[model samples]
Target: MPASAPAQPIKLVIWDLDDTFWRGTLSEGSVEALAENLQLVRDTAARGLVHTIVSKNDFAPAEARLRELGIWELFVFARISWQPKGPIIKELLSQMQLRAANALFLDDNPANRAEAQFYNPELRVADPTELPQLVPLLRASGQPDPTLARLAQYKLLERQQQARTQYDDNLAFLRDAQVQVEFREGPAAVLPDLGRLEELINRSNQLNFTKRRVTLPELEASLRDPTRRWGTVRVHDRFGDYGLVGIYCLNEAENRLEQLVFSCRILHLGIEQFTYAHLGFPVLAVQGDVATELNQTEKPDWITVQAASAATETPAVVATPTGQQLRVLLKGGCDLGQLTPFLQAFDLDVAEEFNFNNEHQIPVHLEHTLLLRATREWPAAEQQRLAAALPFLGREAFDTRLWEPGYDVLVYSPLMDYTQPLYCERATGRRVPFGAYQDITAEPPAALAARYAQRRFQGMSEGFLQRFAREFEHEGPISPAEFQQNLQWLRAQVPAHVPIFLLSGAEIDVPGSGETGARQRHELMNQALAEFVASAENCFLLDVRAFVQTPADVTNNLRHYHRRHYRALAQQLAQAIGAWQGQGLGHSPWADLKARAVGLLPAKLRGLLGR
Candidate 1:
């Protein structure tokens, strides 16, 4: 038995007839068609290429010449128009359901080639004379070319177009097309080519959601996530199988859709709607500059919309006072210090004089210690030492006493306190270990009243317990349920006008030499902490975990950030504070004037005038 001819992968081969496919323009004079050029079209078409013609000529004259050469039917599409060649080529490629990136556009006129390349830069443009050279290059791509499937699909579209009574009624045609879609869920095993999903997601533009391009390892990790669902969509019709054309990864826990992408080759085929429908098509909330196919092409009715009751509620805006320095009290381990420069830039003062009166720095580990000492749970020597150091307020000191540390804002974090042990180094380079307090039992709510009592003895003044507390609870490695209850009590102690900004922590850990059990605890605590912050009614939570990538971005030790990390931290803090303030941090009178001046003009007039 004789071997069948191998299918050519190149989908379409477009030819320009005037002085390109033939010796001269048919309209100007009698043009002689080159035998080799004619054979090139015939051979390419026979090898499963959809040969097409685009030329500047009278349609009748061009068709007559093609008919004389007995090759008119070989061309699936022919455009003899006075309009620009670029747009016509785009239409032809779209009609054929082929990507411009894969098709070859051959024209002798440099101007025509430039026009086509301009419209779709991905198109492979070459002079007809380069046919001998281009054939080998096409073969080198090594794709198994399916013969004439594109042409048959194009013919079906053309028949549908002819049958339509009205123009531009694509919805009617799409409905009548009898499109069949097979939606597959879970893992790369469902895909015919595993890497194809990655390629489609990375390459697709108009259909992308997050526009996140991932490596194979990342894709594998996503598939492995218990909360994530992976989907692959293969579309076909009575006309042909379009192959696996769409892929998406959905995070069920966050209700976030990531990297939803489809091949533009199947742009108008309703594959996108079919795929999203399988996953219960989510209501898209536009973020940034996402240019989806729905934004470009006509909108379809088949989109899966989330339930009405599931919609996110808008947060109530808090009113902030204008024109006063934002007095911020720093708490938390060490990262709180990183916010100093950014805070100062925004007229947020953190100096001792600006701090609430009677506020004294206490070691984080000693927080539990102070609880013991104030409750008289400390040993005799320790109790006496603490009593002498802070005599004004203790169990025996005073009735109805308050720890006054006056500040408009408080920033605190228990991240380092929960994650690591505390210690003080001596001048001789000897290290003194402060106990981790992992064994310390949770104290009663009534026991923490004197947390700041040591400072009250120094004759400082102001709200000892009523100042607004601001905390960056960036991920802590420990989950203390009592800590959450403490936040509610703290909010209750502060004035109603005071804001409790709880900035959430980032994912700061990298894989290291640690017990597997410890790692598991850290992950659980991080997740629980996020949920806790989000649920706080009186707290303004700034989830900074979105900013942390690899542990190196925020910190070297995964707990404390380097000074270099301050730039990003500052910017995030600035945005968060701006929102909390109801305006920008550095909003001066001059900047306001400039903004007002710009806002006065009509949008078009402003654009014309320039900024």
Candidate 2:
């Protein structure tokens, strides 16, 4: 096979690590890290292009090396091993749900590239020497995706694929997936996504049934035309949300489909056939070589139409008095501070109560259930004495807006309980949750102080570290039983009428993250949290595991997620809140869009803009 220009835009870039992604072979010696390749991966990834490895190397060493280089998390569905490159690349593309024609394979060896092309005839092949010419084109390929939402979606697909392999029966996997589709009809619903509609109509091929392309002006006109019933299809499953995957234009006047197209991302999900059946199996003039054959009688039993929530469909019955905003106090780790703006987009007045640096220059986290209990139960003298004794806990740490009656609703995350280790005061036998995984008292004071210093943490001086070690006994993270007990106590503390929504942790393994067994820890905590929510009144669980399934879904650790996921989380939180209130919360699409755009800005710029 000879190399030719891709028929479609390159959506994926497959890299051969040795002498290609980096300078030298890993099996032989330390490879010189390629600065250009590193930056290219970052730049191209931000623009929605997916990258993966198809190198013929040992998996462990190659993974460790990639981790050392700080680019291990960027790639998904990595196929690194001493395997034939040709067959591996072909299978890799299949698993990634990508077409070979829309993928570029880069290898330094001409023979490797030739072999890959032989297996995948349409795959674009390039030598490392061509990167100087190819970098610009690759960078310009995808639309601006500052949050790497596209990358996240593909990661979701990768997870789904991996899980699918576990089941020998495909139908069983689909059934277990719990696939759901939501259809949006009418001009008001479909017009806002005019750009996406146009793109799918023109760019999609494998599932483009009518093959009727339209310009933006024509699309806008057709959407308004009463004769055409246009609808957009959104799909989600146990895996994650696949937003607006398919579009259909039904000619009601003739009972024929003018347009029925879907992104290949939803291929094999039976969405096309599902959508056709949902639309009463409209007469469709079949286009050339569609991946799926549509039939009139069979609708996929695996996929069910997700019913629009009563709150979302109708004006929300305000929980407070008329014209008053619902006061929501969000309490959690500082990372959850990202959800405030998105939550505020709904008809709610949001107040944040996150951990902050105290007078002793140490960060104090107060969201722990025990701390919440101490705020009211502990005597003033005792509180002051402990506040003075422990640098990690300040006088203000015991104070929280949670006890204040000013707020009507509470959005709380008990992640600190899930991640932090507890230390007991030898004198009082009172336990206080602090750092994660490590016992502070067990570490040498000098080493601990130096580690804290590197993080620019103050007040963890050698003197304080020594004093702390002498006085406090290390107790590991809270057990699931104790966690449930605390949850019960907290519920009793808050008023019965007030709704408490808890944000659960992501139970995904983050590779290269030093936090060992974090996913297992989260799974344990999440189960306890779910059990508590099931029995507790007015308590809800904003489950993140549905969307945050892979290592790539999180950053650095399991507790923190990519910025875009925060928006999805906020949306989930709002819906749960609305359902509790017995009405849908009002939303500002403009505000949501603005937040998304702001999320794309550089961190410094976002900070300067006060986002």
Using TM-score as the measure, the top candidate is: 2
TM-score for predicted model 2 compared with the true structure = 0.53
Best by lDDT: 2
199-276 per-residue lDDT for model 2 (tens digits)? 788878888988988864577678779999999888888888777788999999899999999988788888999999
Q: Could you tell me every candidate's TM-score relative to the true structure?
A: 0.37, 0.53
- Writing each residue's lDDT as its tens digit, candidate 1 over 237-315 gives 5455455567777778777677578765566666665565556666444334433343333335532322212212112
Worst 10 residues of 2 by lDDT: 309-318
Model 1 — TM-score against the truth?
Answer: 0.37
Candidate 2 displacement at residue 401 in angstroms:
22
